[model samples]
Target: MNFIKVYTLTALFSAFTLIQATHANAITAPPLETQVKQVAQWFTGLFDNSQQVATNPSIPLITLSSCSVALTNTNPVTGTENIYLEQKSINRFRLYSFSQENSAVNLSIRAFDTNYSVTGLCNRPESEHTLDSSKVLATSCNLQLLWEPTDYIGNNSPNGCPTSSGGKVISSVTVSENGIDSLDKIFGANGNLLFATPIEFRRVDSIPEPSFTLGILAIGFWGTSKTILRKHKQKSTVSEESLFNCD
Candidate 1:
Protein backbone atom coordinates (compact mmCIF):
# COMPACT_ATOMS: atom_id res chain seq x y z
CA MET A 1 0.00 0.00 0.00
CA ASN A 2 2.85 2.41 0.85
CA PHE A 3 4.65 1.74 -2.46
CA ILE A 4 1.46 2.23 -4.48
CA LYS A 5 0.80 5.59 -2.86
CA VAL A 6 4.32 6.82 -3.57
CA TYR A 7 4.04 5.78 -7.25
CA THR A 8 0.70 7.52 -7.60
CA LEU A 9 2.08 10.78 -6.19
CA THR A 10 5.03 10.71 -8.59
CA ALA A 11 2.74 10.13 -11.55
CA LEU A 12 0.54 13.05 -10.53
CA PHE A 13 3.55 15.37 -10.33
CA SER A 14 4.72 14.34 -13.81
CA ALA A 15 1.28 14.95 -15.25
CA PHE A 16 1.14 18.45 -13.80
CA THR A 17 4.56 19.29 -15.25
CA LEU A 18 3.52 18.09 -18.71
CA ILE A 19 0.34 20.10 -18.62
CA GLN A 20 2.18 23.30 -17.70
CA ALA A 21 4.71 22.71 -20.45
CA THR A 22 1.98 22.37 -23.06
CA HIS A 23 0.32 25.59 -21.94
CA ALA A 24 3.59 27.47 -22.15
CA ASN A 25 4.07 26.30 -25.72
CA ALA A 26 0.63 27.58 -26.67
CA ILE A 27 1.38 31.08 -25.32
CA THR A 28 4.96 31.08 -26.54
CA ALA A 29 5.60 33.78 -29.13
CA PRO A 30 6.40 32.92 -32.70
CA PRO A 31 9.88 33.53 -34.14
CA LEU A 32 10.77 37.14 -35.05
CA GLU A 33 11.39 36.22 -38.68
CA THR A 34 7.94 34.66 -38.89
CA GLN A 35 6.31 37.70 -37.36
CA VAL A 36 8.16 40.12 -39.63
CA LYS A 37 7.28 38.01 -42.64
CA GLN A 38 3.60 38.03 -41.72
CA VAL A 39 3.54 41.80 -41.37
CA ALA A 40 5.57 42.26 -44.57
CA GLN A 41 3.33 40.01 -46.63
CA TRP A 42 0.25 42.00 -45.68
CA PHE A 43 1.89 45.33 -46.47
CA THR A 44 3.61 44.17 -49.63
CA GLY A 45 0.27 43.55 -51.27
CA LEU A 46 -1.21 46.78 -49.95
CA PHE A 47 1.77 48.87 -50.98
CA ASP A 48 1.92 47.38 -54.47
CA ASN A 49 -1.66 48.42 -55.03
CA SER A 50 -1.12 51.85 -53.49
CA GLN A 51 1.98 52.57 -55.57
CA GLN A 52 0.07 51.85 -58.74
CA VAL A 53 -2.67 54.21 -57.66
CA ALA A 54 -0.14 56.92 -56.74
CA THR A 55 1.19 56.93 -60.32
CA ASN A 56 -2.32 57.50 -61.61
CA PRO A 57 -2.92 61.22 -61.99
CA SER A 58 -6.11 60.84 -60.03
CA ILE A 59 -4.67 58.85 -57.08
CA PRO A 60 -1.81 59.10 -54.57
CA LEU A 61 1.21 56.83 -54.59
CA ILE A 62 1.97 55.28 -51.14
CA THR A 63 5.26 53.32 -50.95
CA LEU A 64 6.55 51.44 -47.94
CA SER A 65 10.17 52.12 -46.96
CA SER A 66 11.26 50.20 -43.82
CA CYS A 67 10.21 48.63 -40.50
CA SER A 68 11.55 46.96 -37.30
CA VAL A 69 10.45 44.76 -34.38
CA ALA A 70 11.11 44.28 -30.65
CA LEU A 71 11.83 40.94 -28.93
CA THR A 72 10.63 41.44 -25.40
CA ASN A 73 7.60 42.90 -23.54
CA THR A 74 5.14 41.41 -21.05
CA ASN A 75 2.26 41.84 -23.50
CA PRO A 76 3.01 41.84 -27.24
CA VAL A 77 -0.26 43.32 -28.44
CA THR A 78 0.77 46.99 -28.80
CA GLY A 79 3.49 49.44 -29.91
CA THR A 80 4.20 52.50 -32.15
CA GLU A 81 4.20 52.64 -35.93
CA ASN A 82 7.07 54.89 -37.06
CA ILE A 83 6.53 56.46 -40.45
CA TYR A 84 9.25 57.74 -42.76
CA LEU A 85 9.06 60.16 -45.70
CA GLU A 86 10.48 59.32 -49.17
CA GLN A 87 13.27 57.54 -47.30
CA LYS A 88 14.09 60.78 -45.47
CA SER A 89 12.23 62.44 -42.59
CA ILE A 90 10.89 60.08 -39.88
CA ASN A 91 7.67 60.61 -38.01
CA ARG A 92 4.69 58.85 -36.49
CA PHE A 93 1.78 58.22 -38.83
CA ARG A 94 -1.56 58.96 -37.25
CA LEU A 95 -3.15 55.70 -36.02
CA TYR A 96 -6.72 54.34 -36.22
CA SER A 97 -7.96 51.20 -34.52
CA PHE A 98 -9.83 48.34 -36.30
CA SER A 99 -11.26 46.41 -33.38
CA GLN A 100 -14.84 45.57 -32.47
CA GLU A 101 -16.94 48.56 -31.42
CA ASN A 102 -16.45 49.13 -27.70
CA SER A 103 -14.37 45.95 -27.66
CA ALA A 104 -11.87 47.62 -25.32
CA VAL A 105 -9.51 49.01 -27.97
CA ASN A 106 -6.67 51.51 -27.41
CA LEU A 107 -4.68 53.26 -30.14
CA SER A 108 -2.33 56.26 -30.12
CA ILE A 109 0.41 58.01 -32.13
CA ARG A 110 3.80 59.36 -31.02
CA ALA A 111 6.06 61.50 -33.15
CA PHE A 112 9.84 61.77 -32.93
CA ASP A 113 9.38 65.55 -32.79
CA THR A 114 8.73 65.11 -29.08
CA ASN A 115 11.23 62.29 -28.68
CA TYR A 116 8.85 60.04 -30.63
CA SER A 117 6.58 59.64 -27.64
CA VAL A 118 2.90 58.90 -28.31
CA THR A 119 1.00 62.17 -28.45
CA GLY A 120 -2.45 60.65 -28.04
CA LEU A 121 -4.92 58.15 -29.44
CA CYS A 122 -6.78 59.66 -32.36
CA ASN A 123 -10.55 60.11 -32.13
CA ARG A 124 -12.31 56.75 -32.36
CA PRO A 125 -14.24 55.97 -35.51
CA GLU A 126 -17.89 54.99 -34.99
CA SER A 127 -17.29 51.50 -36.37
CA GLU A 128 -14.16 49.32 -36.91
CA HIS A 129 -13.28 45.78 -37.89
CA THR A 130 -12.70 43.33 -35.09
CA LEU A 131 -9.30 41.63 -35.56
CA ASP A 132 -9.61 38.03 -36.65
CA SER A 133 -7.60 35.37 -34.82
CA SER A 134 -5.05 35.38 -37.65
CA LYS A 135 -3.48 38.56 -36.21
CA VAL A 136 -0.72 38.38 -33.59
CA LEU A 137 -1.04 38.23 -29.80
CA ALA A 138 1.26 38.70 -26.70
CA THR A 139 3.44 41.82 -26.45
CA SER A 140 6.99 40.80 -25.41
CA CYS A 141 7.41 39.02 -28.76
CA ASN A 142 7.72 40.25 -32.34
CA LEU A 143 6.49 43.66 -33.55
CA GLN A 144 6.22 44.50 -37.23
CA LEU A 145 5.30 47.39 -39.56
CA LEU A 146 4.05 47.67 -43.11
CA TRP A 147 4.85 51.18 -44.40
CA GLU A 148 3.15 53.26 -47.06
CA PRO A 149 4.96 56.05 -48.91
CA THR A 150 3.55 59.30 -47.64
CA ASP A 151 4.42 62.61 -49.23
CA TYR A 152 2.12 64.02 -46.61
CA ILE A 153 1.25 61.44 -43.99
CA GLY A 154 -0.40 63.96 -41.71
CA ASN A 155 -2.71 65.27 -44.42
CA ASN A 156 -2.77 62.70 -47.24
CA SER A 157 -5.10 60.55 -45.11
CA PRO A 158 -4.29 57.07 -46.39
CA ASN A 159 -7.23 54.91 -47.46
CA GLY A 160 -7.04 52.66 -44.35
CA CYS A 161 -7.10 55.30 -41.62
CA PRO A 162 -9.57 54.76 -38.80
CA THR A 163 -13.20 55.42 -39.63
CA SER A 164 -16.66 54.74 -38.20
CA SER A 165 -15.96 51.13 -39.20
CA GLY A 166 -12.85 51.01 -37.01
CA GLY A 167 -10.48 51.11 -39.99
CA LYS A 168 -7.30 49.44 -38.71
CA VAL A 169 -7.77 48.40 -35.13
CA ILE A 170 -4.56 47.09 -33.60
CA SER A 171 -5.37 43.41 -33.21
CA SER A 172 -1.97 42.61 -31.70
CA VAL A 173 1.02 44.86 -30.94
CA THR A 174 4.59 43.52 -30.70
CA VAL A 175 7.89 44.96 -29.51
CA SER A 176 10.37 42.33 -30.71
CA GLU A 177 13.49 44.26 -31.67
CA ASN A 178 13.83 46.65 -28.74
CA GLY A 179 12.12 46.81 -25.39
CA ILE A 180 9.72 49.60 -24.53
CA ASP A 181 11.67 52.85 -24.93
CA SER A 182 8.98 54.80 -23.07
CA LEU A 183 5.43 54.19 -21.86
CA ASP A 184 2.34 56.03 -20.60
CA LYS A 185 -0.75 53.99 -19.71
CA ILE A 186 -4.21 55.55 -19.66
CA PHE A 187 -7.70 54.29 -18.87
CA GLY A 188 -9.81 52.66 -21.60
CA ALA A 189 -12.73 50.25 -22.16
CA ASN A 190 -12.56 46.90 -20.35
CA GLY A 191 -9.46 48.10 -18.49
CA ASN A 192 -7.45 47.86 -21.70
CA LEU A 193 -3.86 49.15 -21.78
CA LEU A 194 -3.18 52.52 -23.45
CA PHE A 195 0.50 53.31 -23.85
CA ALA A 196 3.10 54.44 -26.40
CA THR A 197 6.75 53.51 -27.02
CA PRO A 198 9.36 55.30 -29.14
CA ILE A 199 10.24 53.37 -32.31
CA GLU A 200 12.40 54.21 -35.38
CA PHE A 201 12.42 53.06 -39.02
CA ARG A 202 15.45 53.84 -41.17
CA ARG A 203 14.77 54.48 -44.82
CA VAL A 204 16.85 52.51 -47.31
CA ASP A 205 17.02 55.23 -49.97
CA SER A 206 18.24 57.89 -47.56
CA ILE A 207 21.90 58.82 -48.08
CA PRO A 208 24.07 57.77 -45.17
CA GLU A 209 26.38 60.30 -43.54
CA PRO A 210 29.98 59.75 -44.78
CA SER A 211 31.88 60.29 -41.54
CA PHE A 212 31.98 56.60 -40.62
CA THR A 213 33.14 55.39 -44.02
CA LEU A 214 35.68 58.22 -44.31
CA GLY A 215 37.18 57.34 -40.91
CA ILE A 216 37.73 53.73 -41.96
CA LEU A 217 39.55 54.78 -45.15
CA ALA A 218 41.70 57.26 -43.24
CA ILE A 219 42.89 54.55 -40.85
CA GLY A 220 43.75 52.19 -43.72
CA PHE A 221 45.83 54.87 -45.51
CA TRP A 222 47.70 55.77 -42.32
CA GLY A 223 48.67 52.14 -41.69
CA THR A 224 49.98 51.73 -45.26
CA SER A 225 52.08 54.90 -44.95
CA LYS A 226 53.66 53.63 -41.72
CA THR A 227 54.53 50.26 -43.29
CA ILE A 228 56.32 51.95 -46.23
CA LEU A 229 58.25 54.26 -43.89
CA ARG A 230 59.43 51.36 -41.74
CA LYS A 231 60.67 49.39 -44.79
CA HIS A 232 62.59 52.41 -46.06
CA LYS A 233 64.22 52.96 -42.69
CA GLN A 234 65.34 49.29 -42.46
CA LYS A 235 66.87 49.44 -45.96
CA SER A 236 68.81 52.63 -45.11
CA THR A 237 70.18 51.12 -41.89
CA VAL A 238 71.35 47.95 -43.68
CA SER A 239 73.11 49.98 -46.42
CA GLU A 240 74.89 52.07 -43.79
CA GLU A 241 76.16 48.96 -42.00
CA SER A 242 77.37 47.47 -45.28
CA LEU A 243 79.29 50.62 -46.09
CA PHE A 244 80.89 50.71 -42.63
CA ASN A 245 82.00 47.07 -42.93
CA CYS A 246 83.65 47.96 -46.26
CA ASP A 247 82.55 44.77 -48.02
Candidate 2:
Protein backbone atom coordinates (compact mmCIF):
# COMPACT_ATOMS: atom_id res chain seq x y z
CA MET A 1 0.00 0.00 0.00
CA ASN A 2 2.81 2.42 0.88
CA PHE A 3 4.67 1.69 -2.36
CA ILE A 4 1.52 2.23 -4.40
CA LYS A 5 0.72 5.54 -2.67
CA VAL A 6 4.30 6.86 -3.09
CA TYR A 7 4.36 5.78 -6.72
CA THR A 8 1.02 7.49 -7.36
CA LEU A 9 2.13 10.77 -5.73
CA THR A 10 5.43 10.84 -7.66
CA ALA A 11 3.84 10.00 -11.01
CA LEU A 12 0.90 12.39 -10.55
CA PHE A 13 3.18 15.27 -9.51
CA SER A 14 5.47 14.61 -12.47
CA ALA A 15 2.55 14.40 -14.89
CA PHE A 16 0.99 17.79 -14.03
CA THR A 17 3.97 19.93 -12.93
CA LEU A 18 6.50 18.83 -15.55
CA ILE A 19 4.31 19.86 -18.47
CA GLN A 20 3.64 23.26 -16.84
CA ALA A 21 7.33 23.86 -16.23
CA THR A 22 8.13 23.06 -19.86
CA HIS A 23 5.32 25.27 -21.12
CA ALA A 24 6.47 28.18 -19.02
CA ASN A 25 9.95 27.77 -20.41
CA ALA A 26 8.59 27.62 -23.95
CA ILE A 27 7.01 31.06 -23.70
CA THR A 28 9.60 33.56 -24.91
CA ALA A 29 9.57 37.26 -25.73
CA PRO A 30 9.47 38.27 -29.37
CA PRO A 31 12.76 38.61 -31.23
CA LEU A 32 14.78 41.78 -30.57
CA GLU A 33 15.87 42.15 -34.21
CA THR A 34 12.26 42.64 -35.35
CA GLN A 35 11.62 45.40 -32.81
CA VAL A 36 14.91 47.10 -33.69
CA LYS A 37 13.93 47.14 -37.35
CA GLN A 38 10.53 48.57 -36.43
CA VAL A 39 12.17 51.41 -34.50
CA ALA A 40 14.63 52.06 -37.32
CA GLN A 41 11.81 52.35 -39.82
CA TRP A 42 9.80 54.65 -37.56
CA PHE A 43 12.77 56.81 -36.57
CA THR A 44 13.75 57.54 -40.14
CA GLY A 45 12.90 60.91 -41.87
CA LEU A 46 13.15 64.57 -40.76
CA PHE A 47 11.01 66.05 -37.96
CA ASP A 48 10.33 69.51 -36.52
CA ASN A 49 8.13 71.24 -33.96
CA SER A 50 7.62 74.65 -35.55
CA GLN A 51 3.90 74.60 -34.78
CA GLN A 52 4.44 73.86 -31.11
CA VAL A 53 6.92 76.70 -30.84
CA ALA A 54 4.47 79.04 -32.56
CA THR A 55 1.83 78.30 -29.93
CA ASN A 56 4.20 78.42 -26.93
CA PRO A 57 6.51 81.41 -27.16
CA SER A 58 8.54 80.17 -24.21
CA ILE A 59 9.36 76.87 -25.94
CA PRO A 60 12.52 76.67 -28.00
CA LEU A 61 12.31 76.20 -31.77
CA ILE A 62 13.91 72.86 -32.70
CA THR A 63 14.41 70.87 -35.88
CA LEU A 64 15.52 67.22 -36.06
CA SER A 65 16.89 65.06 -38.89
CA SER A 66 17.41 61.32 -38.61
CA CYS A 67 18.38 58.60 -41.10
CA SER A 68 19.55 55.03 -40.73
CA VAL A 69 23.20 54.08 -41.41
CA ALA A 70 25.22 50.89 -41.58
CA LEU A 71 28.61 51.09 -39.83
CA THR A 72 31.45 48.61 -39.80
CA ASN A 73 32.17 49.18 -36.13
CA THR A 74 35.34 47.67 -34.62
CA ASN A 75 33.28 46.69 -31.57
CA PRO A 76 30.38 45.34 -33.53
CA VAL A 77 27.22 44.47 -31.65
CA THR A 78 24.71 42.13 -33.26
CA GLY A 79 21.20 43.48 -33.93
CA THR A 80 22.15 47.17 -33.53
CA GLU A 81 20.52 49.91 -35.56
CA ASN A 82 22.78 52.83 -36.39
CA ILE A 83 21.18 56.22 -36.94
CA TYR A 84 22.40 59.76 -37.61
CA LEU A 85 20.54 62.38 -35.55
CA GLU A 86 20.65 66.15 -35.94
CA GLN A 87 18.87 68.63 -33.67
CA LYS A 88 19.37 72.23 -34.75
CA SER A 89 23.16 72.70 -35.23
CA ILE A 90 24.12 69.86 -32.89
CA ASN A 91 24.11 66.49 -34.61
CA ARG A 92 25.28 63.10 -33.35
CA PHE A 93 25.57 59.52 -34.56
CA ARG A 94 24.44 56.58 -32.46
CA LEU A 95 24.41 52.80 -32.49
CA TYR A 96 21.22 51.62 -30.81
CA SER A 97 21.88 48.09 -29.47
CA PHE A 98 18.73 46.23 -28.51
CA SER A 99 17.69 43.47 -26.11
CA GLN A 100 14.37 42.04 -24.93
CA GLU A 101 13.19 40.10 -21.86
CA ASN A 102 9.49 40.91 -22.09
CA SER A 103 7.10 42.97 -24.21
CA ALA A 104 9.38 46.04 -23.95
CA VAL A 105 12.31 46.64 -26.33
CA ASN A 106 15.31 47.88 -24.32
CA LEU A 107 18.41 49.50 -25.81
CA SER A 108 21.77 50.97 -24.88
CA ILE A 109 22.94 54.00 -26.86
CA ARG A 110 26.49 54.38 -28.16
CA ALA A 111 27.30 57.81 -29.54
CA PHE A 112 30.02 58.72 -32.07
CA ASP A 113 29.62 62.49 -32.27
CA THR A 114 33.37 62.96 -31.82
CA ASN A 115 33.97 61.56 -35.30
CA TYR A 116 33.76 64.79 -37.28
CA SER A 117 34.27 63.16 -40.68
CA VAL A 118 30.83 61.56 -40.42
CA THR A 119 29.20 64.93 -39.69
CA GLY A 120 26.38 65.99 -42.02
CA LEU A 121 26.82 62.70 -43.88
CA CYS A 122 23.17 62.01 -43.11
CA ASN A 123 22.18 64.16 -46.08
CA ARG A 124 23.87 62.09 -48.79
CA PRO A 125 21.75 59.11 -49.76
CA GLU A 126 24.65 56.71 -50.35
CA SER A 127 26.58 57.98 -47.32
CA GLU A 128 23.59 57.64 -45.02
CA HIS A 129 23.40 53.94 -45.87
CA THR A 130 27.02 53.09 -44.97
CA LEU A 131 29.88 54.52 -42.89
CA ASP A 132 33.64 54.39 -42.40
CA SER A 133 33.25 52.66 -39.05
CA SER A 134 37.03 52.56 -38.52
CA LYS A 135 37.13 56.33 -38.03
CA VAL A 136 34.36 56.58 -35.43
CA LEU A 137 35.49 56.46 -31.79
CA ALA A 138 33.51 54.07 -29.60
CA THR A 139 31.56 55.71 -26.80
CA SER A 140 30.37 54.51 -23.41
CA CYS A 141 26.85 53.44 -22.58
CA ASN A 142 25.53 56.96 -22.00
CA LEU A 143 21.77 56.29 -21.91
CA GLN A 144 18.98 53.76 -22.26
CA LEU A 145 15.85 53.75 -24.42
CA LEU A 146 12.72 51.67 -24.15
CA TRP A 147 9.96 51.01 -26.68
CA GLU A 148 6.65 51.00 -24.84
CA PRO A 149 3.51 49.69 -26.55
CA THR A 150 2.63 52.96 -28.23
CA ASP A 151 5.92 54.89 -28.19
CA TYR A 152 9.61 54.85 -27.41
CA ILE A 153 10.86 56.78 -24.33
CA GLY A 154 14.47 57.45 -23.42
CA ASN A 155 16.13 58.18 -20.06
CA ASN A 156 19.66 58.55 -18.72
CA SER A 157 20.73 55.53 -16.73
CA PRO A 158 21.98 54.85 -13.16
CA ASN A 159 22.67 58.20 -11.46
CA GLY A 160 22.19 61.21 -13.71
CA CYS A 161 25.29 61.91 -15.85
CA PRO A 162 27.57 64.79 -14.92
CA THR A 163 27.95 68.06 -16.78
CA SER A 164 30.63 70.68 -17.48
CA SER A 165 29.08 72.94 -14.79
CA GLY A 166 29.25 70.14 -12.15
CA GLY A 167 25.47 69.54 -12.19
CA LYS A 168 23.63 66.46 -13.36
CA VAL A 169 22.04 66.48 -16.85
CA ILE A 170 19.67 63.96 -18.44
CA SER A 171 17.50 63.77 -21.54
CA SER A 172 14.34 61.91 -22.54
CA VAL A 173 12.77 61.28 -25.96
CA THR A 174 9.38 59.96 -27.02
CA VAL A 175 9.10 58.63 -30.58
CA SER A 176 5.88 57.67 -32.30
CA GLU A 177 4.75 57.06 -35.88
CA ASN A 178 3.90 60.69 -36.56
CA GLY A 179 6.19 62.69 -34.25
CA ILE A 180 9.00 62.76 -31.75
CA ASP A 181 8.40 64.43 -28.39
CA SER A 182 11.41 65.08 -26.19
CA LEU A 183 11.46 66.29 -22.57
CA ASP A 184 14.37 66.51 -20.23
CA LYS A 185 13.03 65.92 -16.72
CA ILE A 186 15.00 68.11 -14.38
CA PHE A 187 15.45 68.09 -10.63
CA GLY A 188 14.95 71.09 -8.40
CA ALA A 189 17.71 72.58 -6.23
CA ASN A 190 16.41 70.29 -3.46
CA GLY A 191 17.10 67.12 -5.58
CA ASN A 192 13.50 66.23 -6.41
CA LEU A 193 12.24 65.59 -9.95
CA LEU A 194 11.08 68.96 -11.27
CA PHE A 195 8.94 69.96 -14.21
CA ALA A 196 9.98 68.91 -17.69
CA THR A 197 10.20 71.26 -20.65
CA PRO A 198 9.31 69.39 -23.84
CA ILE A 199 10.54 69.88 -27.40
CA GLU A 200 8.20 68.15 -29.81
CA PHE A 201 8.96 67.22 -33.43
CA ARG A 202 6.51 66.38 -36.19
CA ARG A 203 7.48 64.32 -39.22
CA VAL A 204 8.74 66.31 -42.18
CA ASP A 205 8.95 63.33 -44.54
CA SER A 206 6.46 60.54 -45.28
CA ILE A 207 7.07 56.84 -44.48
CA PRO A 208 4.52 54.73 -46.30
CA GLU A 209 6.76 51.66 -46.14
CA PRO A 210 6.97 51.49 -42.36
CA SER A 211 3.23 52.01 -41.95
CA PHE A 212 2.47 49.01 -44.19
CA THR A 213 5.13 46.91 -42.43
CA LEU A 214 3.66 47.77 -39.04
CA GLY A 215 0.25 46.50 -40.16
CA ILE A 216 1.68 43.18 -41.36
CA LEU A 217 3.69 42.68 -38.18
CA ALA A 218 0.60 43.31 -36.03
CA ILE A 219 -1.41 40.68 -37.90
CA GLY A 220 1.40 38.14 -37.62
CA PHE A 221 1.72 38.71 -33.88
CA TRP A 222 -2.01 38.23 -33.35
CA GLY A 223 -2.06 34.95 -35.24
CA THR A 224 1.08 33.66 -33.49
CA SER A 225 -0.31 34.51 -30.03
CA LYS A 226 -3.55 32.68 -30.69
CA THR A 227 -1.73 29.59 -31.93
CA ILE A 228 0.55 29.47 -28.88
CA LEU A 229 -2.36 29.71 -26.42
CA ARG A 230 -4.26 27.00 -28.23
CA LYS A 231 -1.26 24.64 -28.21
CA HIS A 232 -0.66 25.10 -24.47
CA LYS A 233 -4.31 24.40 -23.65
CA GLN A 234 -4.23 21.25 -25.77
CA LYS A 235 -1.07 20.04 -24.06
CA SER A 236 -2.60 20.64 -20.63
CA THR A 237 -5.65 18.55 -21.54
CA VAL A 238 -3.47 15.66 -22.74
CA SER A 239 -1.25 15.82 -19.66
CA GLU A 240 -4.28 15.69 -17.34
CA GLU A 241 -5.60 12.58 -19.11
CA SER A 242 -2.22 10.89 -18.89
CA LEU A 243 -1.99 11.59 -15.15
CA PHE A 244 -5.41 9.97 -14.56
CA ASN A 245 -4.35 6.85 -16.47
CA CYS A 246 -1.24 6.35 -14.29
CA ASP A 247 -1.28 2.86 -12.78
- Give one clash count per candidate, in the order shown: 29, 0
The TM-scores, one per candidate, come to 0.20, 0.58
Q: Candidate 1 residues 11-34, lDDT tens each?
A: 999999999988976665444333
Report the C-alpha lDDT of model 2 over 56-142, residue by residue, as the tens digit: 755545555655556655564564555554445222344444445355555444444353455566567653455556654454334
**Candidate 2 residue pairs that clash:** none
lDDT of 1: 0.23
lDDT of 2: 0.48
Highest TM-score, which number? 2
Candidate 1 displacement at residue 56 in angstroms? 3.2
Best candidate, lDDT-wise?
Answer: 2
